[model samples]
Target: MSDIVGELARVAGAFDQPTLTLLYRGHAKVVIAMLRSAFTRDNRTISAARLHAQVDTYLDQLRIDGFTDLPSGSGRDLCLRWMRGQWLVRSVADDGAEVYTLTSHAQDALNLVTNLTRERASLSEHRIATIVNAVRRFNTEVNPDRGARVDILNSEIARLTRERDRLLQGADLTRPSADYMLEGYGELLQLVAALPSDFARVQEAFTALRTQILGSFRAEDRHAGEVIDDYLRRTDSLMTATAEGRAFEGAFTLLRDDELLLQLREDLSALLSHPMAEDILNDVDRRDLRGTVGLIRRGIDAVLAQRNRVTATLREYIQTHNTVRDRELDNTLRQLDAELARWMTSAGPRTTVALPLLPARLDVHHLRERFHNPDDDAGPPPLRDVTTQRPDGLTLADLLAQGGPSLDQLRAAVHEALASDEPLASLGRLFDALDAPLRRPVEIFGLLHLTTNMDDFVRDKEHTEVYRTLRPDGTRRDLAVPVITPGPQSPDSPVTFAEEPRGRAPRLEPA
Candidate 1:
């Protein structure tokens, strides 16, 4: 009786697991359908806002379909409720977007419903063969007696060699029936479907481990080094100690082996192309089979990403952890808690006490140093009478000589030269004909600038032009500039120049 009771209790405990509870709930079908639709092998996560809107749309459609026994509230509220139920997990993704992912329990529930809904043979030659082959392989690897293991391997090799010889001899190939193909495809898909939940388990394990480590860090109950050592040890054992970890390690090995991966792809392609495949499998089945390798790769990437996050968390904590400050804060919090407990014991529910939100200000009487003084603020002694001081006077021509180029005069000279029937051979000839003021060194720059903007000018790279510039002190200096030749202007858009300044040169500087 006790043994039966113990077995019953074990079964009950299994049913109580979140994975089972999810299926046992009132809206199990609706929830499972939603999860399967939202999360797929290729897409494992959805941004929070997108998922909320999707859920709302799903609920709205369900209501329109007359399924009124549905959960109330908006999609966001439903998601939060699902999160509390451990069916949906809300986490910040690597890109810092808040995303929703199906928890391992939720994935398991979905997988179960999928298996149940899909039509599959309960028993088949393919299924039996798979079991037998698995058992034979397991025995060959694990058999304690070396002689037995070697004998098993030899037998397998001999059988395969005989089959290969027969195939090479042009023996007629035996084709599998549609039913057999269907059964095999079903088994393959079932295995493929389970991979997501398996990967999710490993990811959840790492996340839980990280959460525990963070708690330990906050508590400071153990030395940081000891905690880190424990973390490293667990992490190293993680890939070997648990079933999911072992599966991940196997998948990781498969990923590393290029030849094996290629062979897998070839085999899947061959299976998909079989004559029976068309009748046995549908488009969805074909897609799932074709994407098996991609699914495994994604799963491995997700697990590795989760592991990296844990490592980063540990590293960041180690780099920023301040033992002295943490200890001081811990002590202060403990003292505060003790005082609060004592006060609570002596106080009634209605009793109240006035307390300032911040610490009281210091009652300072005086400060010796002053930031400002009235004596220093006195106006400066009446401005010095600089009117009595005589300064040298300057004329407008002196200022213009010291200023920039006379652009108007230079522009008119170039336009006149280009517009004339006998245009100047080079800008140097025009410069020589210009008035003294327009031949200033600065005016040479102005002519070059205007020439660059006109279509009627071409620079002669082989030659140089010298301009005689008159200095403010009445001295002449020859300056060499690049030679520019004026060409004929098109009649359609003739070059127009501003009239030369008629009055004295204008002062360019402020007084």
Candidate 2:
């Protein structure tokens, strides 16, 4: 009776889990389909806006298909609801984009749906063989007796050697039957599909650990060093302590071993190329099989990124945490709480207290004000006329030289050079040939700027050309500029300079 009651309680607890709750909810099929479509093994995360749009589209399609019983609200609202339900996690990516990722519970739910939908024999020769091989290998590795372990290894080696020799000797190859291949493929996919959730579990564990560490810090009961030490110890043990962590470690080890990875790839390729593979797997299945290594790599990256985030959190807290200020704030809050309690005890329920949020303003008998006297308000005397004074004789050319680059003049030069019958080789050559005014140092910037708005200019990064710029004072300076070559320009969009307001420089607008 006790055992039966315990089993019932365990069953109840399992049903209470988020994974089961997701499955038990209304419109589970639609929700699951949406999630599976939105997030995949390769594409684990979707930007919040993109995902919301996708959800809305999916819901629209479902409604069009005559599915009336659906979740109420917009996609964003649904996402928020799902987040609260723990199916979707809203987090900021490293690039600071808000993204939604399926929680491990949601992944488990998806995996369960995938498995249930997939067709495979419940009992198969491949399944039995896999189990037997696993058991044999487990026993061989864990056997306490050295002689027994050696004997087991020797027998396995002998068996493999005989098989290898037979294959090498041109013996007829034993081809896997389609059913056997199908079963194996099914098993492999199931294993592969579980990896995402496993990785998510590890990430969630780290996230939870980080949250706990933060709480401990906020509590201020433990010393920073002790908290750090405890964190270090937990992080060290994490990879070995949990099933997800162990799986992640195994995947990490596999990733680090280049030879092993190469071998795995070769084996997957060989399997994929098998004659039975064509019938056993579809395009999706084949693609998934081919991307096994990539999937593992992505999983490892996500786990490492999560771990790095935790490390960053620890480092940031240690660097920025102000013990003195935090203590002061904590004491202040305690004093406020004590005073509030005393007031509550003495006051009636209906009594009201009016208090100023800020300190009262200072009181003064008099604020000295300056009254406007007639003398003070009197206007200044009339200014002297400067019309009689003669100004220095300056030419328009001199004013142009002292002012900004001659963009309009530079544009005409570039247009004439480009429109010439002879091929205009480069901008530098054109600048060198230009008149003194157009060859000003500032005019070089104007030339480059004009070329940028043109259609056919290509700047050669590898080489540079010198622009011999002439100053107004007759001083010349050669500036090294990137080699800009103009390509064949389109007749329709000719580069033209347009006039602007008086003070503004003319721009090279495309015609």
TM-score of each: 0.65, 0.66
Clashes of 2: 0
User: Top model by TM-score, which number?
Assistant: 2
350-439 per-residue lDDT for model 1 (tens digits): 988898999999999997786778879898888778865755686688788889988877777777777678747887788888887776
Cα RMSD (Å) per model? 22.1, 18.6
Which residue runs of candidate 1 sit more than 4 Å off their true CA positions?
Answer: 238-243, 330-354, 359-511
Give me candidate 1's TM-score against the actual structure. Answer: 0.65
- How much is the lDDT of residue 85 in candidate 2? 85
Q: Clash number for every model?
A: 0, 0
Best by lDDT: 2
Question: What is the per-residue lDDT of model 2 for residues 1-511, given as tens digits with 9 covering 90 to 100?
Answer: 3699889999999999889999999878888999999997678889999999999999999898998999999999999989988999999987999999999999999999999999989999999999999999999989999999999999999999999999999999898778888999999999988888888899998888778878877775776578678767866776776676777787688688988889989999999998888888999988888998888788888899888888788778878877778779989999999999999998999998898999999999998798768998789999999977856787787888888877768877888887778888898899899888788888877877777655567777767888888899999888888788987677676666434332222322211
Error of 2 at 186 (Å): 1.3
